[model samples]
Target chain A: MTPDAEQTGGIIEVRGLKTQFGDFVVHDGLDLTVREGEILGVVGGSGTGKSVLMRAIIGLKRPSAGEVTVFGQNFYEAGGEARLAIERRWGVLFQGGALFSSLTVAQNVMAPIREHLNVEGDLARDIAALKISMVGLAAEAGAKLPSELSGGMRKRAGLARALALDPELVFLDEPTAGLDPIGAARFDDLIVNLKESLGLTVFMVTHDLDTLHAACDRVAVLAEKRVIACGPLDEVRRADHPWIQEYFAGPRGRAALAAKAS
Target chain B: MADSPAYFDIDLDNGVLKLNAGGDWRARFLKAIDSRLRDFADDSVGRDLIIDMSKVEYLDTAGAMVLQRTFHACEQRSAASKFVGANEAQRSLLEQVEHHLAPCFVAPSRPNAFVAMLDRLGAGVSEAYFVAIAILSFIGEILVAIPRVLTRPARVRWTSTFHHMEEAGVDAMPIVGLMSFLIGAVIAFMGAKILQLFNAEILTVQLVGISVLREFGVLLAAILIAGRSGSAFTAQIGSMKIREEIDALRVLGLDPIEVLVLPRVFALVIMLPVLAFMSSMLGIIGGLIVAWTAMDIPPALFVSQFEEAIAMSNFWVGLIKAPFFAFVIAVIGCFQGMEVEGSAESLGQRTTLSVVQSLFLVILIDAFFAMFFLEIDF
Candidate 1:
């Protein structure tokens, strides 16, 4: 799997990954590669650790044994400016939106921009505004606190913040989990549109089958502490595995595929 | 990877300003690109501006955004502009940004100072009114429920009541005992020092006996409990409210006041009087210790002086106020918790308010009690 994942144009490579919590092991010998400018969706049964792999790559969780290379630099070994520089090139949208409850939506978006770049004040504000609008929120929503927004709007606001610095890569964790069907579909459209417009290489951990059908260029299936299948959704769907079989051919999965066809 | 520093070249040719932009125009390199583009925007006023991106090696949304903003500024200054020589990716980036340019954002206006002050004053007044109404209603609910439970005898939650009692009374014994002892000792020490001037050092026993039995014991216990158990009650109930457990109780056809507030109220009402009596005894013993150690009076002599100075009425007066103080502290804490809203911040704010209000009201009621006792001369 690592040999397959170690291809050219890979923006992120996770090799020989193992994640454990105290005595419980979450992942072992997991391998994944997110190609440049592709939306890679990672799916798994609950407790199979789709998010642990994302956390391992993003430097939030220290893997017990692994090397995560981001832009070809070993993420754990990088220090100071090198770490900051890599961080400057990517953004993460957490499951809860995780907006600073104290700041307005616009200020939350402007935060990363002001942190990493030097620019005129008005321009910085307008850039934040542009991002908020691009995510399909109203201009008035910019002044809102995160607690004031509904669940769907909060996720969109989080996405706007993720895109504020115009990073080459983005990580989304359960972006559509709580959204209504229409909101989730619109969110899928939004992410795909942003990827097309911004050429972002995305690593998404999600449970929504619709998101996978609509937004993902490739799908990776996690089971038994490793990726059991990884390729384009169709190719991955054809994998002769139990979880993949129940997932893509399951009733809800078939509904997702039908919706995509329609 | 080293980013090639982006640069721009501007030249006005035949009423057409040709701006040449080059190098890696990524997010980190856009600050310089934006400033130079701004300078070009002013020079190209009322002229056709052509931004040539053929020389640019790399481009991202940050760069495309700055360029799009420059186009917008140029349009505002009444200049016609067309972007040229951008490859498919860069063109798409610019188009996407240009198409979704946000509606003009006007920063929210600040309220006038006088208006803001009036607003706050009105809010505070209404809040105080609501709080008064809430406290009365909650007290009424408890009063109504008390008789209903008392009639059944088996309806009371004995376990919860005893738990609160243990937490608020039994657990608090050491601190209450120590505090009263120290207070009583200090009162006697001061009394002896001041009375020494009048050759009335023997009056120190009377001073400690009357003061500790009548006021300080009850007051100290009430304040300490208000700060400790009162705040804990608010935090507990407020967190339950935040987690929607209060609603869960209501959904199951149980009154929150009956389930959550009544046990705590009963525990405090039952325990405070006993604690106050114990505290009074400890305070007297502290006074006795100080009198014996400092003034060469024996414990038997101090007890004889204390028996003469302290009337049973002083002990009753102190013990009587305990139940009232306890009731207020418990009611205020539980009521503030029931008022909790969505966030953890709300839980925190309500907890602080519960403690402060409990302390304030306990002291306020004590003052009224003081005047009442003074009028009756008990």
Candidate 2:
């Protein structure tokens, strides 16, 4: 599929993408379109190629086949500066938060801004401090390094870093992986609030069923080396595929459904 | 998941044995033993009776021993028993246990040798390749850093550099000072002894100053740092890489080379010369102490003579090599640290490589400097 054909008011359009590691294929002819101002959740079992697909879209891992267009620009076709510019237009929240342990929470948030954006000195610090506070972390927490923060707090700090550039598009990889139920739910609420306030296009890879139910506009199930099901919650739940049926009908799935109902 | 045994039963009455096979050979053997014991209890037949053992599968020396012991007991009762199911493998195992038992056991065929050799060769090659990969990773790190010296300027992390130097230099001063003083004293004593033989004991100052400034000072300083600071850098960065902080930097659009590596390289480049100069002065002072006491040379006369003997060129040569040595240590340290993958084992391996490589490069570079200066008329 061509890059232009996939672009349809979507911040990211991945078409016929394939990623392989030696003989093992992670993504095979996968197509996905994440629209503007919507949280699109990519869900799959472990080793279902969810993270690889995300990495490919973000230009971290090069795909064996197909195109990824972000913000109407062909990601692979662009040169270094051009690609960097495209990257600046979007932020990534890596799995495990991936915070710089060496830098304080405030500095970690300020990194991208200082690198890509040309803000200087005290102004940069102020912007960083503000972003940290925006993510529900206190100004005092800004002085602490990532090692000092709790898991949920680290994720929040990572989210703050992602939001630093005021990017129209954001990608979160397993954002609620290790948090407790209450923490995960609170994170989901925070994500929803951020998306609504910033008018963001979110492409999130997650296993948290509650987050999918509460925050996602569309849930995409990756199976059979492709997105086998993609639609709103009700449509996806009705999918005839065995994996999807079992996945959403399982104990965890029921718990999430029950939580939503409550 | 229930813990249940599946097998046959064996009963023994008095001296008579009765065998009953179970679900499988292993289980059947267990049941057979039980049946034999029940039979021995119920019957008054002699314990020495021949029993068939041909139904057993994959027997070994242990199984044979069980049968052998039963046979021995039967013999004591004036009865004899033969094992009917002894396979060649079982016979071989029996023979292996005791050479004297070979006459009582059967034998098995041996496998081909070429296949075994081929398997061993393949395993050896793979292990060799793993080690080669590790070495290549170290080389790859150095290659990666060379480009950083030019392309990625921001990787020169000055903040970390100052922090490291404070630890590497300031914290290191006492030991370096003490060691340099001792080294100078030894040199002074050695020089005085040699000069006294020639009745030119006053030349001890010249010998001490020249040796300290020309080679000992810079080399000693570098060796100390390589053991202390260089290893520390490798461990710190290696641990960070293992923990994914480096990856975090890249994802955040920060170049690790600029942010982490550059400052270290910059700091070493700045600090090593100062360290070398200090080391040289300290080493000379140490030599002066011994020269004064051992040779009966006055402290004032020794100082003047030592200062006269050491040219500006001697000091410059030692000082100049400091920065280069520092660069070698820093680059090797950071490069090896960055090369670390996965675990603490990689950290250790890289740390050793850093020290060895840095020392080798330092000495090699020092040799070249020595040769270059030797060619000059200064």
Candidate 3:
């Protein structure tokens, strides 16, 4: 949709990824690539390892087997010093916001910048405020702790923190899950606006079909230990897979599609 | 450093300043650009402005913000401005940045010093009153539950009681013995020092026996157990409260007092007196050691003198206070735990308060017991 996306390049490439917990296997032979400057929505049923996939990609969970690279480097091989720079390049919004309970919202947003960058404190505070506002959190919310805010507000605060470093690639875990419909719609718009503005490569794991229709430029459906389909929404929806057919053709999916069409 | 990657130049174009922006204007490289833009925030560019981002390779949000602020000096003076030769992505980013000018940080202001002091004072007074009321009500609740428990012996959690008994009583034997032994030794030594001048150093046996049996033994045991187990009860119960386990018990039609509190109280009450007895015996032995070593008192003669000095009433006076101290400590600990609200900070505070309050109350009760025993001439 924009010139940034026109110069498409592979930003993250995962090949033959294998992840497991104890005896239970989660993902095996998983392969995916996130193109630069495009929102790639990962969709799957519950317990299908959608979140596990996101965690594996972000290096929070080490894959038992296979290669995962970001910015054309094998981050798994990159030691602590080399990995710090890569870690700084991407931001993640956890499933539950995962904000520091003791720190106020603004301080939470400023943490990464203060830790990783050498910017002045006041300026970092300013950047944090800007990011908080950009995520549509109220100014008053900056002083409140995470426990004081509702789930929706906490999610917005988390988004602010995730955006604090002005990261090029962002991973959102169910960004619109707990929000009300209006708030969810606004969040989708915010994602689209952010994509247009920042040219960010978004790796979003979501169950919200509306988000896929509104914000995501492409969709990757994960199932059976791998991404069964990955392409534009329409193309993936037309895939011969039974799960994809049920997913996009279900009543709720039809409603979301209808909403987008109008 | 040799190459100018992200840089800008300003020039006057028909009374309108024109900005030439270049290089990869990303967040990583925006610090220099941002610092450069501050010079223009305070300057007076006395005309309209145009930001030429045509030559910019990449423009992220931070870069857009810096570039847009470069001409903010002119824009503030009602000088019209627009982006010239900018791409769609750059324009959107600039618009977003413009919409969100960094707000000034205002720390939450504190109240006046005097007002804050008064606030704290008032809170302390009310909190003290609340604690008094809470403790009283908690005691009443236990009193009410006791009759019900007595009626049904099966209601007592034998498993939990035995567990707490091991935790508070049997396992505490070595420490109690050691503590009393040292106290006994010190008393004997002190007794010999003062009485030696009067040619009555042999009175040290009477001193060790009477003091250990009447006061030191039970007092030492109570205080040690108060610190060790009272804080633990608060922490355990307070975390349970935080996790809503207490509420869950209530919802399931089980009284929390019956389930959690009574087992601990019963365990401690039964165990404290037994510990006190052990402490008394150990203390006498410690006193005997000192007496034997320093004054050359044989074990046989020391035991005979000890029997003559410490009457059964002296041991009874110390032992009688054990159950009371145990009951109070257990009640206070569980009460403070139940008082805990949701935060980790609150749980920590309640645990500290539980230990402090139990220790203070135990000592206070000991003073009252001492007065009562003296009145009765026991």
lDDT of 2 at B47: 46
Candidates sorted by lDDT, descending order? 1, 3, 2
Task: List ranges where model 1 is wrong by over 4 Å.
Answer: A1-9, A118-120, B1-9, B22-47, B55-57, B76-80, B103-107, B190-193, B292-298
Q: Candidate 1 at residue B283, lDDT?
A: 92
| Interface DockQ per candidate | 0.50, 0.01, 0.38
Best by DockQ: 1
lDDT of 3 by residue, B1-378 (tens): 243467888888887777888887866666666765776655745557787887888777667766665656566455458788788767777888887765634245579999999999999999999989989999999999989998999998889989999998898889988999999999999999999999987788888888999889998999888888888889889999999999999999999999999989998999999999999889999989998888998999998877776688988999999999999999999999999999888999999999899999999999999999999898
B378, model 3: CA deviation in Å?
Answer: 3.5
lDDT of 2 by residue, B312-353 (tens): 888888888898898778878887888899756679988998
The candidate 2 chain B region of ten consecutive residues with least summed lDDT is B99-108
User: Residues B92-178, candidate 1, lDDT per residue (tens digit)?
Assistant: 888888866664343455699999999999999999998899889989998999998889878888899999999999998899999
Off by over 4 Å in 3: A1-9, A20-29, A43-50, A207-214, A217-262, B1-39, B43-47, B52-58, B69-73, B76-79, B102-106, B112-114, B154-160, B166-216, B283-298, B374-376
Q: List, residue by residue over A53-156, the lDDT tens digit for candidate 3.
A: 88888888899999888888788799998899898889999988999988889889888877887665556776777888899887888888888888889888
